[model samples]
Target chain A: MITIEFIPFSQMSGLSTEQKIKKILKSVKSDKIVLLQGKLKKDEETELIKLTMSMVNEKFHGIEPAIFSPEIKNTGNFLKFLKEKFINMLLSDRQGITLVGPANLIKEIKRDPEKMQLLLDLNVSRRKKK
Target chain B: MLDKIRSALKSLFSGFFKKKKQLKLGLYGPPNGGKTTLANKICKDWLGEEMGSVSNIPHETREIKIKEQILIKSGNKQLTFNLVDTPGIATRIDYEDFVKAGLDEEEAKTRAKEATKGVIDSIKWLDSVDAVVVVLDATKDPLNQVNITILGNLQAKKIPVLIVGNKIDLKRADIKKIENTFPQYKVVGISAKYGTSVEDFYTELFNLVKP
Candidate 1:
């Protein structure tokens, strides 16, 4: 069976960077795909990848993370650009969605400006046979 | 306040008097993307030496390797920089995969451990690089998360980037697809192994590190 867990930004608002990563890793290790409400900071993403690498074992391979956000185009309008920047600062977490899942389960995650496609390897029985 | 003024003046004078520092050019991409091959080619072309060994297996480069003082000249123009060859970045590393590639169990586990450390090191080195050449396999799909994450991070840092579509000797190689996928950045196609179009790559390098 597969499970998906949604974690809102508020749930991680007060946690330290390490703590947030641990919380996400705990869920991924349990074979649950986490649907985070917003994107992680760039450094946070790097730290998460580093931490995930340390936890890889036979049963737990790693995590595949992807972020989907609206594209910020260059309209060449100064006022509009400033307005967008102001909005981004005000609601950073609400700007995008992040998906993180166990690498063994999620085969690939492809994204473009329009949409994201997640491919899964559902051959559990074959995997068990191996 | 006095210290701040002193530091400001120091920087002002250094900018005018200091010799130009060598640019650090980083080679980054997914595993088995011919990064080492290109590194070897570049090193051999100029220094008559190879940067590191290449293998058919993934994660062959489990540490960052640097080849310093590589100089390339084109007519009256010349550029010199330190070449940084980083391990292939991957979201997953399983020892079983290594075993399947004909490694013993113990060796596979050890390789997996080293590969993880390599990934961490690659991420940390991003802060130190002045420019980057993002090498990609021309035969593979270019829309994967690893490529996106690498490019996004470079964009966020405002680092100058030149994407290389490598392995174009193969029949399935499609450099045009990579070009369309990343229209914002400059893309060059070259077969690092056969030395095809490598001259163009060197020409692009001159523009990549333009001051």
Candidate 2:
């Protein structure tokens, strides 16, 4: 059977985004498939990549990260919108779901925009296990 | 002699890197955004089958669902891919919210727990996908947190993305606003529940996955 480790972002509320990302990186190092419940903040997501790239070495494989979130809802009157926009200009409040895994373990990531599906290349993974 | 051997090896190995056999297409959006409905429509149209069940409740698809090997044709163009219908992604999953949606306390909590895990699973599956279709309700505002997060993440990963403005059959559907919000992407409006402009969706989709 296939195994995937689920990591809900909510559960890590006590930790800073950076700390959570560190945990994800550690999980990927172990070849554990990690699913993040909430999406990473823009800066946090960027930092995660920077850290991953800097940390990758002969002992560690690179990570593959993907995120999904719900649709954005536009609401309220002009003044309320302006207030939110002004605040948003200074603070990044974007959030969603994110997942990370070992790049070497996952051979290929194929996406079909029309059908909205994500297919994996399992052959390479099986081959590597041997 | 070395240069000749290197050129020979390059040519011989080139065939091994031929076009991919199948693509992974992921359906993503907020809860109750008609992702499953769209998944069903695609399956019905090509595979002559239904992918999954749908309901009025939110997060109806609490687990990641897959329908493999769908080959869609448009004129001489042929596209083959696997369909991945992910659980609705939410910033928050409150058990009380599920209770309000009509589940009992225990069941609501259970569902909320499962839905929460489902969200994680969907996000995790992202690294395994090649492209994504962001399904949005055409009648709703397109500037919410979840939508922004999805877009930002895809941009970071450099993954090809297409936006689906679903539920156009509804009177309040505003495809233009969605288009304006994400001027960078190809946003196609359709009603997955009623099959409106789905052909155009397919066309746009074909263009989206092109290498």
Best by TM-score: 1
For model 1, what is the error of residue B140's alpha carbon versus the real structure, in angstroms, after optimal superposition? 1.3
- Model 1 chain A lowest lDDT segment of ten: A121-130
> What lDDT score goes with residue B30 in model 1?
90
lDDT of each prediction vs. the true structure?
A: 0.90, 0.77
User: After superposing candidate 1, which stretches have Cα over 4 Å from the reference?
Assistant: A72-90, A125-130, B1-13, B16-20
**Model 1 residue pairs with clashes:** none
List interface RMSDs for the candidates, in order.
Answer: 1.6, 15.1
lDDT of 2 by residue, A10-107 (tens): 57667886887788888877777787776677657645654564555434535656665444335857787777666655443334457676765554
Candidate 1: tens digits of C-alpha lDDT, residues A86-117: 88888886788889999999988877778788
